[model samples]
Target chain A: MKLTKLLATGAVALGLATGAWAQDKTKVGFVYVGPVGDGGWTYEHDKGRQAVEKEFGDKVETVFVESVPEGPDAERVMTQMALDGADLIFTTSFGYMDPTINVAKKFPDVKFEHATGYKTAPNVSVYSARFYEGRAVQGHIAGKMTESNIVGYIGSYPIPEVVRGINSAFIHARKANPDVQFKIVWAYTWFDPAKEADAAKVLIEQGADVILQHTDSTAPQAAAQDAGNVITFGQASDMSEYKPKPRVSSIIDNWAPYYIARTQAVMDGTWESTSTWDGIREGMVEIGEITDAVPADVKEEAVALMNSIANGEYHPFTGPLKKQDGSDWLAEGETADDGTLAGMNFYVEGLEGEIPQ
Target chain B: MDLSAINPVLLVASLMVAATPILLAGIGELVVEKSGVLNLGVEGMMITGAICGFAVTVETGSPALGFVAAAVGGALLSLLFAVLTQVALANQVASGLALTLFGLGLSALMGQGYVGIKPPSTPKLDIPVLSDLPVVGRILFGHDLVLYLGIALVAAVWATLKYTRAGLILRAVGENHDAAHALGYKVIRIRTLAILFGGACAGLGGAYISLVRVPQWTEGMTAGVGWIALALVVFASWKPWRVLLGAYLFGGVTVVQLNLQAAGVAIPVEYLAMSPYLVTILVLVILSADKSRAPASLGRSFHAAH
Candidate 1:
């Protein structure tokens, strides 16, 4: 009788232990296009995920899978994570659009967040930053600093996001200095350092004193450092580590506030499907401190422009622009609307080349 | 098209750099096949070279030393295939495929630390007056040393095969191993040396990619370059100069497509991106259709005991 009673207690204790542990934490999952320590795009997103953990302490549990290619593989990973009880999942990449939608359709209970994608289901939401706003600032700096009147742009692909950045930078730079021209080199990839560096070298040889890139690597900055006196900006993260040399300023994507707010919404039971596109005005996009590379007057002008943009007192893209083919694009004092910016597939007049069809 | 926008110099220079990895791997495979060894582990060995090259470059801050490490890594991995096929007398085709699979997985693990770090820059050899000439300067005189070495290797291999007595013996062994064995040439030893040389070249190619082409380490960075290199050996009809021609031709397609996009040609980005691979396939199909050009002992295995 005593042995039977002891056995029943041990079984009961084991069941309670599992139940308690499962109930103690809320599970969150993240899938990335690159390794978490890339010190660039995925690195910044991982930082935000870490912020969520710190804020909630023991209340939340998180898991991540890195270097997950976007396609059927992504669908499998998402489905598996949901089946394993991921309350919320973030699939980060433009290519993850269909996968996120497909997974959300199957798992209605799981919340899905996709970066730079447009597909949406009842349980899914898409989000992207106003990266063009940062480009506007870089354009202003490039316009003033360029003695050769030439700027180089390393483009990854002719996607809307990359096209939008090129146009925005051109719009603002031409506004500051009418003589400024853009020399573009398409590397045809999101991250290929050799190609990107070679493109930069070609541009530098072509007399471009300032360089910009839409690809996700610091190759441009490294190339700029080697070229001496050339200027470059950081993409996706604050790469101030290479500061006081090639990196004059950086466009820092602040995803922490959004991540914290979204997780809290999940906890408070008020989570709803919505698209959030925030910029410097909403503290979602941040500009790193200008280094000693810039002249004091230029720095002051840039800060003034930043304040105006934040306060809604000025617009960088307020227009008087022409297409590369010398066609009228925007009327005087008229800014491009969201629709035009979203589908921007043409190069403006100041850019010497065309955006291929 | 704007010839002015082409920058003939940079185009030629880029082509040379791009061709080196392919050339090294292809020429190595050519030697292996000439000696009646079929090794598909070229891809695996190339990847091993990539990771090993990147890791050493990161540690030592020297791209040259990294290339050396890459060769060593590639050779070591190739030995796995050698022992399996030579000692165990395993099927050569299956052993080669296994080597590729193992190489890919091992490189991914080894490359964890090198995921995003920028590798050390390769040094440029500016050929004084030649580099200053308008069109020729950028193309011929402005390439890194690897480009020149790759060209010289092609010539050296060509001369050895065409003129040297050792070349005659290697050819004799590959053509009729049993007859060569009776005449006192160690067929196994010769074939093994050729296999190791192929591995070293593959490693050099892999290193050239990590140290020059992409200049960073990522999972699957070679991205079928090894396979393309293998295909080129067949496309070249086992000739050294033809291998160079095939490599540059493929490299030209790659460079041209990118140029088209940059110059704002009216092609969809996806199609433009896939064009090079498509053309490569078409070229292979056309070349392979002419079976008369293929080697007699292309995939034959020789066993002394048998």
Candidate 2:
């Protein structure tokens, strides 16, 4: 009899709690692919999440589940948040695309935003930043600084986003220094530090003085620092802690403005399914200060390149570009379309070796 | 493929550094499994040690003291396992899995402050002229004291297991705990000590990564390496020297595959990614197929009343 009474009281309290959540607070949920303390990719996404909280104050309630593996498990996290009265959910990782769509179908009223992904539904939105624009600036500096003419690239995965960075960097690198070469190593992980350090060491041993990574860790920067001469560019967040040498420059991914705007839309009932891909011009992709490690002229050129891309005066993918097989991709003075760049699988011309299938 | 770009001497040097953590963890697990206590919490213990070591190093500004604290922290956590499995006679597997979950959460909470903060480097073994020789210097002397300690730990474990009376007694207990108990050997006390030792070694391995290898602290930075050490012990047929070799070979495959990819080698990326596990297992599988096998009383709980 006592157990039955306790159960009835517990049910009433739970109902009232959830009832309070629905009546006033706009609950926003975030699912991260790596730990929020990763100091790189997930770190920036978490900063965006925090911005949402700061923007709305008591009007919004924010919750997040970090280190979520990108598979069927992601669907479970999204489903739980939706059932718990999450008005909007942001699944932050390319791998979460399908899982986001699957969970959105079940909770049609729950708006879902998936980052760095392509799939979308009436209830699901897809968003990404043009990080290749920053990569172009990195390549320009790398080509100018590398005494060995060999720049190493540590790629997280062979997805379009990563492959696109490789191509964009290589294209500008070749233009900067005709003899420049790129050595690409795919790590197959987004967040393993030991593996990333090993990959950086391997590239350094093979004579790459300039290292640009798409992986989310400071291990590569540490490895480069230990090597004493190598220079690296930070990914996702400004890893300025290693500044003045190893981390000469960085690509800072700013998602706060977008996250704030989207959450505001949910509160105002103006939320709609959308595909948003913003970059330098939109302040989604930013270039961190080019440090003294880069030559003055090279740094100046990099800044100029960044400003041109930001102001619509130049496109990083401006043509006379060719595919890896020597076939023409873009005609002279022609720029790449968003569709081709989004699904980029083949490397641009003059890039050695094949993109691993 | 530009094979010329692949420098073999430096590869040998980096592979050893890469293999050190697993080597330490594998040798420790070998001793634990030899005592018939299967603690599957090596992963949990390792990450805990990583944070403990990192946090201590950052606070005290001494990597050496940090390593000691890590070992103590890991052993302290493992003492919980020792109590549950030895004193209470609880299920070893379930307790170990629970310990891992507990350790991961515990370490994350502990390491909240240490994230992105680089630990003070472990002081190098400056062997004067020996460290100046070109290829030989790099492969031999281009490392800190902890790395040499990892290799030395393997050798000491091998000598102790083969030559010491304590090893024989530990083996006897593992083979038949009931008979050993009748012979006046305290099975519970022996396992608790062995569990502590296993926990300490796992801690040292975790510290090697956090202080020397990656040399930075991040939540979950151990990254499934403890589980790799667990498999390595079984693959080495519970032998110490073979654990050292197996770790190097495993570590070598990973470093080499990355080099191959960077050199633009034409091998499929998927195959190269899986090659480390395949090569390690292929060689160790052949070695483990002989008469040498697991202990007679492995994973079976021992209670005097039973």
Candidate 3:
């Protein structure tokens, strides 16, 4: 009887405290798949969270749990955050798609946002940056710079996101230099520095003078630096510390503006379930500075390509493409629809190796 | 498949560097187990060491001091495990798992500022004539000091375990801690010291990864390597030389599989990705036919009054 009385009082006190706080400020929570210090994907996401804090100073309270694993644990974390009076939650990473939706169902009034995922619920929204647009420019640079005609790519996973990047990069590279060949080594992970470095070394040893990676980490940049003449592009962030030599340029994911807009929408009661895919024009995916290592003409061409893509003058996957088996994909002047790009699995023409189920 | 593109000398050199970290951790755990304690906190100690080494190296611009600090950091973290299991008579398994969790969290906290900061590079030992001996020289002499130290430690461990009086006492303690206690040997003291040594070794292994291998600090950079080292100790049948051999075998498979992928081998990429673990399991299965034994009193908490 005493334990029950204490529990009842404790529950009442907690509810009253949270209810009072909720009236004044909205509580927002973020779940990151990697440490906020990862200097890549999670780091950029955390920066967006910081932007939210700066934008909504006294109107909102923000909290984040880092390095939360995907699957059941993610669902559990989301449930706990919702129970703790979080008005909105952002679960970053593709693996959190299902968990975000599941949690959204239980907390119908609470809003949920997921990054790099396709799933959505009545109370959940999905958002991803068009990283392939940036990959096209990197491919053009790699094609122009490769002396061996061999460019290496390090893939994190065989998911559509990575496959789209490969296809986009390959298409533009072949356009710039018909002799260019791509050798891809799949590390099957988002971030393992040793493995990433080893992949870079093996590519260098195999005569790939230009390297690209979808994996987060600057190990490949370091590897390219050690190999002297080899060139690399930073993935997901401006790993510009190795500039003027190895890391000549990079694709930076800019999520701050989107994060602020969504937070504002939630506060204004205008938030709705929607899937958004924004590119360079909206300032979601940014291309980092092209260092002097890139030739003047190649740099100019890359800049022009970026401007064209941003201004809706060019489509990376516009026709004249074939599947690896040499079957027609997009005819000349024909562009790939978002449906095919969203579920991209096959390699384009001239690319070898399976996607790995 | 373009096999000619793969350089034999570079592959051997790269594998050596790849195997050193695990080999160091495995040999250390072998000693800890030999002293009748199973410290499952190798992963935690390793990440702690990685961050400590990276931070110290970045701050002091000295890779050598960074390694020393890594050893100290690892040993200090393992001391927590020692206190819980040795002094408090806590459950070894539970305490060890807790230690790993604590270490990972603590290291991440410590590593928050050190991320993306490159550490001082450890220079390779240039041994004049030997380093210029064509392919052999490049494979043997063109490596940093840690690679050589790892091989030397393996040889030293084998010699000590096989020939020294201290090794006999350690073996005795592991076989029957109560009997060794009855014989007036300080069983707790010996085990504690062994645990600290094991921690230092694991730390060095982690430092090797951060300071030389990848040469930068990243969260969870050890990335299940500690677990691999633990499995390696068991796979080696608690023998130091076998641990070295196993590390090399696993490392060789990892390097070769990457090479195969780069060469565009017809095999599926998934199969190639899992080849290292698969080959390790295959070798372990083949070796287990000999019925290797573990130390009898391993993982048992020693209480003098009991």
Candidate 4:
């Protein structure tokens, strides 16, 4: 009877230990450039993380740290997260690319995904939306709606991302209306509402009735709303509350689907490093609800354009184009490939200002 | 020269506005250091000001009132350090460093809501005739009220130190607090007041960053401007006028590099970007070459009982 009791106790202990070991949660971490509650970049990213929680339930766990500047501090935080047993990490900023790559090298088992960056390692993947596609649609709308024919562009930096957006917008705008002109202001930062608003004011004073921004803030929309009769697009997220006053249409960054898919892959053990520059076709970049403020005919045209792009039946960057220097850019029936678009440094022919060195 | 691309006049104006926060912080620090008080917590004081100014502005909807609140908030934070160093007779350097760390964490917590929201427009002053002049007109005359205030502060501080009896008493206390105490000048009180004033000025500078310069409360928006201000006090050798020159010079370097980039100058962005910091360090090395001019009792702790 004593031997039987000892054997039964031993079996119970072994079963409990195995069960506890199997219950280990897979930890996922995120780093953001802005606070999670900002209702913008970091907010959208956090929403995606929450979506993962909803989808996975108890299969995984999520954690985040906000307002981390892109520098040596980024590396430290990333390493800390990895040390804390994060199975996967997402760094959301272009400046975080190298740091993410560096950390990925140290912990080869950890999966890293860097946003808006090109560099990739064996354990790292790069992901960014086709933001310029949305710019093209915004450009078309601005080109049609503006009575002033002067469009103001609030650019964060002269980096290729912003510059490409400017060119893409200009290309489509000038295509629609030859007389349309753009006044550009370089705020040289991703987020600064004061500078962004000031730049918008300068452009408005200079007679721009339609404004677009590459910066990450609603200041441009606020400034446009305050000015009255001015129109601006929602950047990074749908800002419908300010509709008609400022936001008419927005380029919504839908990360939930991607987040869910990625997390599911991690659960299924099918996760592989890949660079994804998804757009309307992949449903990563979405054009938000077009408001009634836009003319019915223009709205119809915009929707059709969006549908066609989403169906891959039309490309915003279709060419018969030339560079600002009058060099042949694309031949007839040619569209700009991703390779050419990735390193776009020159402006389109109609753009008046020179690219900043 | 692409005049339209790189408008020299507008460039100068922007530089003055951009430099305002640093200028305000730097000048205030210079005064504090001149009084023989070493408050390296300008960054902390500035961030405290930023959060306070932003919060008040959001609550009251009046930026002007917010700025006043910011100054008070900054001075109050400084009082914490003053007590530690003055009453407790702690090490000023360590206490100042602690203040900075505390300020940064506190501001981050306080600035949670004001992150993406835009503040009210900062009023700009347009001098009638001067603003209309070619070249120099736009550079000097057309700016916000703070630019002129910054300039006036340098002159006011210089005159006070050079010509006023109050300045002499303050200087005497700074030079030898032991002697000043023996002479019945109330050394601790004067130093405390000077420290408070410095804290207020630094706070205003910080508020300028959130309220005017960046026009948004960002985490670490001051971006080492406070440290640069601390360095400037040394670079200026505790002189008010030189502080002005240093602020403008550093401001000019920043403006010029930006202008060069806008003008499509062939230099790499990273090199031009790093120039301001590099030059500031070089200037400090040159200025401190004659170490005889430095404050006699800088970073010294005072104990009345001892």
Candidate 5:
């Protein structure tokens, strides 16, 4: 009798709490692929989340679940967030592409934003920054700085996104220094510092004077610092802590403007499903300050290249290019279309290893 | 392929550094399992130690003092597990898993402010004349004090477990706790001490990662190494020297795969990335084929009754 009375009272309280929560204020949810404290990729995304809060104040409520694995578990978290009255949700990371779509189908009223992905529904919109643009600048710097003529790239996965970065960087690097050779090591993880460090050390030992990484972490930067003369560029975030020596420059991912815009869209009832690929011009992909370690000429060249890419004067994937097998890929004076670049799987000419299927 | 890029001496030296943490954790678990306690909270104890070590080192500017605090922190976290399993007689597996989740959360909470802050660098031990000997010197002599300590602990553990009377008692308690209890042994007390030692060792391994390896405090920075150390203990089949061998083998595979990639070997990157885990499991299966030698009363609880 006592248990029944208590249960009835608890149910009433829970109902009233959720009822009050649903009455007003838009709730935005974020799902991160790593811990916010990673000081790299997830950290930047969390900064964007905070930016939304700062923009909207009490008019909006933001909640986030960090370190969410990219699989069925992500779907469950999204589903729960949607059910809990989230008006808009952002699923960050490429691996969350499918899960975001799957949950968006179930919660059609709830708006969905998936990062670095290409799937969409009536409710799900896909967005990504052209990180390869930043890679082109990094390539130029790496090419000019390499005394050993060998540049190492640490890849997180063999996905199209990563392959594109490698190809873009390699092309620009080889252009700057014709004698430059590329050594690629795939760590197969987004954020394992030890493995990333080991990859950096191996590349350094192999006479690579410059290291490029698509993985998230400052381990490679630290490893380059330890290796004394090796140069590196920060990936996904401006890892400025190791500046003036190992980290000469970096690629910064700026997601605040887009995140704030999307939240405002949801608030104004103007949200719609769309695919947005913003880069330097859109201020989505930013180049961090090139430190004193980089020669003034190289820094100028990198900045000029970045400006040209930003102002539509040049494309990173311009033609007179060949596939890895030496087959003609892009004819002279031709440029890669968005379709090809989006689904890019094969490496450009001169890259040795096959992109693991 | 650019095979000339591979340097044999540097490769061997790095493999030792890579193997030290797991080796330390494995040796600690070896002792705990020997005393009939299967505490699966190695991951939790390790992360707790990582944060504690990192925070203390940042505060004191002494890596050695940080390691001491890390060991103590790890042991304290393990004490919760000890009380639950040894005193309260809760199920070991569930309790251990809970401890891991708790430790991970606690470490994340503690490490909030310490993120991106660099800890004091651990200095490598320079042995006067020996460290200068061309190739062999760097491989053997030029390492931080912890690397040598990890190997020394393995040796001491082997010697103690093989020859000491205390080893016999611990083995007796593990193999048949009821019989050992009848023969006037404190099974719970012995197991508690073993658990604490395991926690401390795992803590030291975690510290090695945060202070020396990655040398930073990021959440989940230990990143499943505790579980690898757990598998390594079993892969070694409860032997100390074999644990060292297994650790170096795993580390060697890891380093070699990266080198192979750097050297531009023709293998697929995916295969090379998975090689360390595949090799470790394969060797474990091959070595354990003859006989399965695990402690008989491994996960059983004990209580003294009137």
Candidate 6:
């Protein structure tokens, strides 16, 4: 009888210990659209996740599911994380907007943070970096550097974010060199290296000396290196391995600061559903070091353009812009409102093609 | 549309590079299906080869040795599938599917440290005057050694399967494994050898993508090429030369669509993007109606005891 009582006491203690442990730790789950090693967008988001871990230590537990396709499938992953007792989750992809919303309704108590989506709920927060500002800088450099007067762009899906980037880059390129022409190819995938490489090479064969890509992956950089005398800018990550040559400069998405702050709020019970769009000024989008492949004067001009955007002294979609069909958009000295930029679907004048709607 | 910007010579040359990977993998799968064993693990095996070849190339700085390592890696993985289906008598379909999953997971694990590191490039075979002979030169002579090897492999496969003794025996076993076994032809042994050849060829195909095409390692870099290769084998009706033709058609359309988009042609981008798949299927489907069918014993597990 005494031995049986002892065993019963041990079982209760073990059960209580697990319950207390679960209550004490805040679990954060991350859903990534690409592998952590994609070396671009997903890789940068994962770095932010790592920063959260470093800040909170054992008080916070982190879990991540990578390469989650953006469809009904993403709903299953988000729901699974909620069922597993996650306190907050970050869905990092533009394609996961609907899935994030659907799962948010089912798990009303779990907090959801999605990247690059506009929808929000009582428990859902949306955040995105203002990447167009970086594109303005890249365009200035691309315009000044292209000896062939032809610049190539590889786009990953014709989303508003991508459309805005093309407009911003084209505007600056035209501003710098009136004779510059833009050649655009939509790759439709965010991270297929072979497809991205093919797009870059095709553009090169058509006489484009300067290449720009909004897709995630360093394939274009490698293609540019092989083509010799061609230049490309790093996208989403530093891609420092190809520095000083094909990769002359870069637009880096730095989410660590925002990730850390959000986690801290959750821990302190101060979290609220909000929309955050931070750019270079707020340190969410950073401009990587400009390598010496570019002339010193051109790098300085690019840096000046970047500073103007950060200081709010300039907006990428500034005055005198027109729609592709020649309809007036922003009049002289007028800037685009956040709502218009958020749902951007039209190409600016001289962008050379339909948005592929 | 600025039609003048599109270069026909460059377009054909790139399509050859784009087609080599699929050609290599398709010809390999054809041999496997011909041996009365169906392995759906081509994707997994190709990805495994991609990493193995990439890692070896990065370490040794020699693309040739890297390709050899890729072949060995692919064959070793296929050996697992052979043992499960041949010795233990597992369901061939289930075993093949499992092998694919295992290969994908294993490759992802092996490729951990190899991402972002560019491998040494495979040198192009510049054949002097022939390489400079305008359109003919660019399309026919200006490709890496492996691209030529892929063509040579298709020729060798065609010659051997159509005229050689080993080819006759292999076909007889695929047609009637029981009869071949009754005649003391060692049916299981022949099937195993075919599976190994398929794996090695698939490995070489995968290395072509990592070492020459994209020339860098990324997870799932082979993407859907292996599946395309598998479909090409069936689409070509298990014929070697047609597989080559199908690969070029698909690759050619792929390159041309991108070129069209770059040239700012007025075609819908989505339709252009899918035209390669459509054109290949339409051509091969029409041709298959005349005199083509799958091997009878394909995907059937054989047992001497039964």
lDDT of 4 at A189: 68
The lowest-lDDT stretch of 10 consecutive residues in candidate 4 chain A is: A14-23
lDDT of 4 by residue, A46-141 (tens): 889999888888888887887788889999999988877778899998889889999999999889999988888888988888989888889989
lDDT tens digits by residue: candidate 5, A109-192: 999999989989999999999999999999999889899999999998788899999999999999999999999998988988
Clashing pairs for model 3 are none
Candidate 5 runs further than 4 Å off: A1-23
Candidate 2: Cα lDDT at B193: 90
Candidate 1's displacement at residue A170, Å, is: 1.0
Candidate 4 Cα deviation (angstroms), residue B239: 2.1
What does candidate 1's lDDT look like per residue over B2-54, in tens digits?
43555556666666776688889998888887777889999999999989998
lDDT of 4 by residue, B11-51 (tens): 67766776777788888887777777899899999989988
Better of 1 and 2 by TM-score: 2
DockQ computed for model 3 against the true two-chain complex using alpha carbons: 0.62
**Model 2, retained fraction of real contacts?**
0.67
Q: State each candidate's clash count.
A: 2, 0, 0, 0, 0, 0
Lowest-sum lDDT 10-residue window in model 2 chain B? B112-121
Write the residue-wise lDDT of candidate 6 on B4-106 in tens digits: 9999999999999999999999999999999888998888888888889999999999999999999888888889999989887788888888887888778
Tell me the TM-score of candidate 2's A chain. Answer: 0.95
Question: lDDT of candidate 4?
Answer: 0.79
State the displacement of the C-alpha of residue A293, model 1, in Å, after optimal TM-score superposition. Answer: 2.4
- Model 5 clashing residue pairs (backbone): none
> What would the per-residue lDDT of candidate 3 be over residues A300-326, giving only the tens digit for each residue?
999999999999999999988899998
Q: Which lDDT tens digits does candidate 1 get at residues A1-357?
A: 675699999977875664466455777889887656455677778898999999998888777887677689999999977876777888887778899998899999889998877677789988888888888889999999999988888887677888889988988898889999787777776665555666776677667899988876666777677678899988888777568768899888888888888888888878889887787899878998889899999889889888888888866667687887889988898877777776678888757655756
* i-RMSD of model 2 (Å, 1 decimal): 1.0
